[model samples]
Target: MMRSHRLFLIAMVAILATVLFRVPAKADYYGEPAELVDRATSVYKGFLADPNLEWFRNNVGSARGILIVPQMLRGGFIIGGSGGRGLLVAQDAATNKWSSPAFYSMGSVSVGFQIGADVSEIILLIMTDRGLDAMLSTDYKIGADVAIAAGPIGGSAKAQTADILAFGRSQGAYGGVSLEGAAISPLVDWNARYYGQPVQIFDILINQKWNNRQADSLRQLLPKPRRNAQPLGR
Candidate 1:
């Protein structure tokens, strides 16, 4: 039991070090937030087209918002770590139109085991107003602020009360993941750079005016929601 606890602590430290030291040193406008928007668009399109993700496709009409993480890496016992940055866009309750994406980073140390590595593309569907509010906040803990669960794959799955439903497509020796205690925070600078002005999550998601032309294609992809929501994805 002590050994397991030690491993978890080590994992958290590695993740913290990487987020603190490695990310900001990048030149080129910190790798350009526009590039992330492009990647997010592709990821969203792929999920919609994937046949294996039937539940997501069928039930997406009920989601209040969607977050797309183009890549999430998990590896190593020592010189390795796990983290990913993503974007969130919510549907306007009044207009029923999708808003522009807001930049966010998500990280977790509790993915995979002591050995091996994996990479995944993840999509999260926010099911309620509370879930959407959490995403709009500067910082959010997955299972603490609201519940989150792995979205079902096949048809037999029933509805879920969780605030967020996560879907991941992974590859590598250690292939699966869980977001139970993951930390998510807004990428404030990235959001400013991406839109050519500083903006808050409320402006980007709720008021729905903080937008960029590059993201229009991505917003156009989301389905229109129903007047009523169902427990399944609503």
Candidate 2:
């Protein structure tokens, strides 16, 4: 009887600790680091190649810099399981090289008992000068002071040729959800591993160093920007 009581106490303590302090498990899809890196790089290059992406990148290039979060976050019903990390690489305007990429994680909670997963790539283009400035700080909250908008639809890429811009918004899985109320921060550890260089999140995303690489890559992959031949203006 005493042993049973002691075991119950231990189980309770474990449950409390899990709830109070929990870090999402590291994402290692297919257990291949090189494959993951290649996947991420390809996704970014694909965006650069898309004609619509070219106009979007150009319009936002005027911002102090851009913040890109390539995400894959999953969650479900009663079990409440979730975990996925992403890389955010900033481009430098003067140097034309990509800054080391930073890491970030995504989390969500729900009640029902639905079990499913989504795999997608995402990028947040900081369009305004003010948007980049605020994010450069140690900690920034979305929707509080920053102005954000839903990213353009891949299908409507042609329709949005005019370079309409907005603050940081999400792309990828469960599309159309706003990241306005989300908490985004820079990842110090990831930058060190991926680039073999020390970097802070703000330095990569806000400063203009890596910005140039992104701009140049897009330009090379896409046609020069031009006005929309078929105006939806009317």
- Cα displacement (angstroms), candidate 1, residue 89, comes to 0.4
lDDT of each: 0.76, 0.46
Q: Model 1, range 1-234, lDDT digits (tens) per residue?
A: 999999999998887576445532321122777788888888888877776666787878788889888887666644445678888988877788888888888876653346556667888889889888888777788888687888876656656667899888875211124787778899899999888888888998889888788988887888887667665532
Q: How accurate is candidate 2 locally (lDDT)?
A: 0.46
- Worst 10-residue lDDT window for candidate 1 reads 21-30
Give the per-residue Cα lDDT of candidate 1 at 143.
Answer: 85
- TM-score, candidate 2, is 0.55
Candidate 1's C-alpha runs over 4 A off are 1-30, 78-80, 110-113, 172-177, 231-234
Q: What is the TM-score (0 to 1) of candidate 1?
A: 0.81
Backbone clash pairs in model 1 (N, Cα, C under 3 Å; residues 3+ apart or in different chains), count: 0
Give all candidate RMSDs, comma-separated. 6.2, 7.3
Q: Against the hidden reference, what TM-scores do the models get?
A: 0.81, 0.55
Error of 2 at 222 (Å): 10
Best-fitting candidate, measured by TM-score? Answer: 1
